[model samples]
Target: MKSKVIERIAAKILIEKYQLLENFYPDLLSGITDIIQKGKIASRFPYIEMKEDEISILIKAKELSELKIIELWNNQDTEEFRALCSIYFDIATLLDKDFEFKNEEEIYELIKIISFGYLGEHNHFVKNYLISKKELIENISVPEQWNSRLLVTIFKGIVCLVAKHSWKDIDNAVILINQLRKEQKDFESKFLNTVNEDSRPYGSAELVSLYHFAKTVEILGQYLLEGRVNGNEFDIENKIKYHLSVAKEFANASANIVLEMLYKYFEAFSIKLINIKTMENKVTPNQIIELINSLPDSEKHIFIENGKYWVTQEWLCGAFAGRAFVNEILEDAVQEMIDYLYKHIGHDSMVGNSVTKSGFPNLERVKQYCTPVESEQD
Candidate 1:
């Protein structure tokens, strides 16, 4: 029988309703020839890279200096400049790049621009990209790899909590986070007592867990810190930069722990390969092979499985490396990360109030975990 394909529901909702690259750019250019004319938008830009060029042109030709450029950048035709600037501005906003824009209007403007693109030429690339991202995001499911699988369990639990903003979602989110706090009481009786397997140094799957924990935690924390948000017209377009920033910080903390664990595992694995038994320079390749050949079948099997921690191939003597399995998981997640930022850029670069919103719970977040959204939305 053929296996069923699982669609990541939360990721899809985040993308489409939140306007992650969902036609915002194509919409901006729909009436490009008319709304932002050739000679008219001297200080505006079409793409992200051109913003600097636009500013330089304004300064050189029109003789606008630093303050004047700021004035022009700020005070230009609201609809025209916003639509142009936001391609870069909104991306920066989502990324919290340089600084965040405080005005709700600016955020609202992004929604408008993305909505415009929805009606015009659709950017299937952005949509496809975001949809593809949905596949990468999973709750921390593989718990067997950790020493303290319960901590792994906690990480998974907290991840779900902070992943949404509705009244029901927030209530549960609060409950989950508090549960993690309470778990400090027992479960081997150490506070936040993670596996601490730096010595045994478990597999890289732990790192994958850490990565998802980071992603999930960030999403959830953002919801709590920022309070509420809506996707599309239904309070979904914009919200909670402060909360997101905090959540990202927390996620990075988990990532750091994962990094430390991976490095230590590699260190331990490397030591095993070296010639500590004889205490001379490291053993010769032939000597290492001979040593392995002498081992019994069970030892050999165990050696190979654990040896995978140090290197990939069977023949190598010593390259001093671990498999870095986290990279595989990270690779999938990183693509979604890139797409999310790009979609925000697309959304941010809109003009006027003629924006749009889709009732979210479609993809990016809706803690219950359902099938992905493109099939339903499409």
Candidate 2:
């Protein structure tokens, strides 16, 4: 009975090492037992001399690594978690061949080392580590049988997202996502066949990976659209605004600026003219100036003296000028009017100063669609 118990323990390790499942376990056990009975365990080729010191060293190293990880989590040190993940990955690689683990948990802890996004290292190491031991992962599936597929897919997606810009290499990201999608057919059979609904959260990691892959595709699509816009000379006022409004929902700050500029340019094309019937009924620029000047100095300064053009030739100038109020309250609406030209139209001949200085076109030319006199009273 004592010998039988020893055989069972040895068989467990052999099954884990070779990744043999229930069907092959008995034959694999018999083979290992023959080798042990023949005294080939220690005298054989490709042998590792397992000593008490080596045993104690691996135990201490694993314990130290686990404790450090726990400390990092408790301290909320994101960088430290990233750092130790690297250390554990190296240890897992070095121990793969000759080290004898006492049980499955130790082996599983090493596998979890790779699952924590430690894969920012070389891709070849990551790819080989995942692809080489397909059988081992299949037999030792702990979190779920399909966790290996999801983990490997996420690692590949992160690599593609970080390296690519302007839609470059998006195909690589698509390939990883496509592989995950293709696995859906077998999912019900491989996963749903044995899983009970009592543990609803059991397969959450798989769902998370699916969701993340969808987001990655959306982000990549935004970059691609931006690149297309940059290459083409579409009507900036009309076409670009529509594209960028959608893009801004997905992109970061740099892309947001692009969207804002496009909106401003489009607004320049759409001016609201101040309609006056005839000279009797008309409020000409001069009349508007006189009316502005007749008020008290504080009020006069707000409109005419400042060379404020409330009318945009193409769109309502007051509307675009008013955006500065978002940052501060404008107590002096006239000084606000004075600074408006300096803000939108520059001292230089080229109009729409902000967009022009930013290297966007003089889109104010499109403002010819509406009539606004842009001149100061002498």
Candidate 3:
């Protein structure tokens, strides 16, 4: 998520979107500013009552567009999508079609926002260009390079493939999934051949997250392909079961990976902070914040800072998602690393527990099923 960009054509395009949207949506520029006084619009982040006009959001997004890629990426600013076409296409092709991109950074920024929630966005172009885009994406020179997007493409293909089978339309779903498996295999091999634990290309954590994500679906897709989607009986009852199974798997995988994609980038920062010989001790967010504040007025500012978007651990749409789930993993990951470093350096007992302090309560209260069970196997 380290972003450093001088040319932000994608940024400009997004700023321009406010202008472009007036043509179609007719709300941004000239309106009486109902958004500030409106009933409410749900947002991915915590929603707040607006005391200012709606244009302030756009105005802030404009400033956000100019920030260097690293700061922008660390923020994972939602405004990134305000310019990139979210509704226009799925994460798979959000960048496939041409844009007036001035640099690779823009493409990366576009990819970041799309990847964060790819599974949630339907590929509107699937029926028309899934195959063609597969061919085009083949030429991109690296599989891991386009990690999350590739996962989204394959997962979307799986959804389409299994959807037909779950409806007792086995003849067609089988054909479609076979083709998808073939194309996906080709794509998978290209990346798998080059990437490894050490030789990972950029966005490696996202790539790993994508790998596990695709693997989870691929397992279910295999089951569906082999007539196990609903236990081989193609009845209406079995069909519904198949669909429910796929949904269950999708929820589990989504809950697990989406935040991994967010938190993995901090691995290096965590290591460096506690690695100093004199400071061979564990640190918490509270500790780190205190240390940074203790720095001299003329000292260089620390790159690490509070996240611009609130990181939450609770997710309730399905599975164990929501802000609480996200925050728990994030806090635990941070504390674990802090503890591990302190121990590695031979420090005294210093570790922290991740408590569910706020946000939607532990989603276990709402989810009827547990995380998909893992069976011992070869």
Candidate 4:
């Protein structure tokens, strides 16, 4: 059977089993049926070629009992299930232009499925689905299990806003990103608190999520600066300055967390190595200090004093270089540090090194980078 036939059959089975259309959107059922009969529903299957297993699952779905079908639908790990859900949403949209999702459960369900699909492949339909639900997306409360997925979805939405280039979109993007950063920090804190061990490193998932948001905000700041210089349609120089300032703030926050995590990891590793007395050439605090001392003058701002380690842009660069010594889990932390340094110091030509570099981001320096050059007329 053709893909559309299988998809339509899958949709019918879903509707019959869950009665979602009948219960929540009684008016849509006939429109959905009419469109299917007339072949007016556009093919919304993901662009990738379906695996044989997924095709087999869909073909056999018609034979399965309702319980079995529900099992398949709930099994998010299977490609066939995601495909089915995508088709269901596609049918809904065709039937009703607004695709008004009535309740939080429905929205959460959609985000869970779409977020999974988004991480694997760049699905334009899924992204558009999220963009269409922007208001609901902002307001709904996500369950604990699905918080990470929701974060990923919101991050993608912010990226979409940056690409659109309108002033309203950019302003909304700024708001969303700042909100996203806060959510990520809270998520990470909650996650770390749940771990039994006090010295265990930060979760890689949280680290990577934080890194992506921080990097995206930094890019958005640059885009705002470029817009201020190139366009006259929007007088947003102050907005650009504000955005850069916020971006610097986020970068500093990310850098502080990453640095602390790295320090804890190193401390934990040193303790582990020290416990293994049989092993020769174990890592030591003094050795780490010597390594820090060997860093370039620009990086001398990083040092261990009174058992506390400090981070600077130069130190972050050095940490990135020696990242291999750290565990695989800290890889995202290393990348975050490098991106933070590059954003604040590496490419910025106007800002000079400061006497009181606090190992955190200098907002003044960031503003200096945003200051328009003499040649570019306002």
List per-candidate RMSD values in Å: 25.3, 25.3, 23.4, 21.7
| lDDT, model 1, position 50 | 34
lDDT of 1 by residue, 258-359 (tens): 334322222221222121212322112222223334433323212323323121211111123111121122222222332332343325422111111221
lDDT of 4 by residue, 206-322 (tens): 355345434444344334423222333133334334433443344344454433322222222222222221132222222233334554463444444545444443343333333
The digit string of per-residue lDDT tens for model 2 on 125-220 reads 544565555444435432344544554454444444333422333455666667667775676357655666764343443344334434434333
Best by lDDT: 4
Misplaced by over 4 Å in model 1 are 1-167, 185-378
Clashes of 4: 0
**Alpha carbon lDDT at 37, candidate 1:** 25
lDDT of 3 at 133: 40
State candidate 1's TM-score. 0.20
Order of quality (lDDT): 4, 2, 3, 1
Over 4 Å off, model 4: 1-132, 142-153, 159-166, 180-187, 198-202, 217-378
lDDT score of residue 315 within candidate 1: 18
CA-lDDT, candidates in order? 0.30, 0.38, 0.35, 0.40
Ranking by TM-score: 2, 4, 3, 1
In lDDT terms, how accurate is model 2? Answer: 0.38
Model 2, residue pairs in steric clash = 270-314, 270-315, 271-314, 271-315, 302-334
Candidate 2: give its CA RMSD in angstroms.
Answer: 25.3
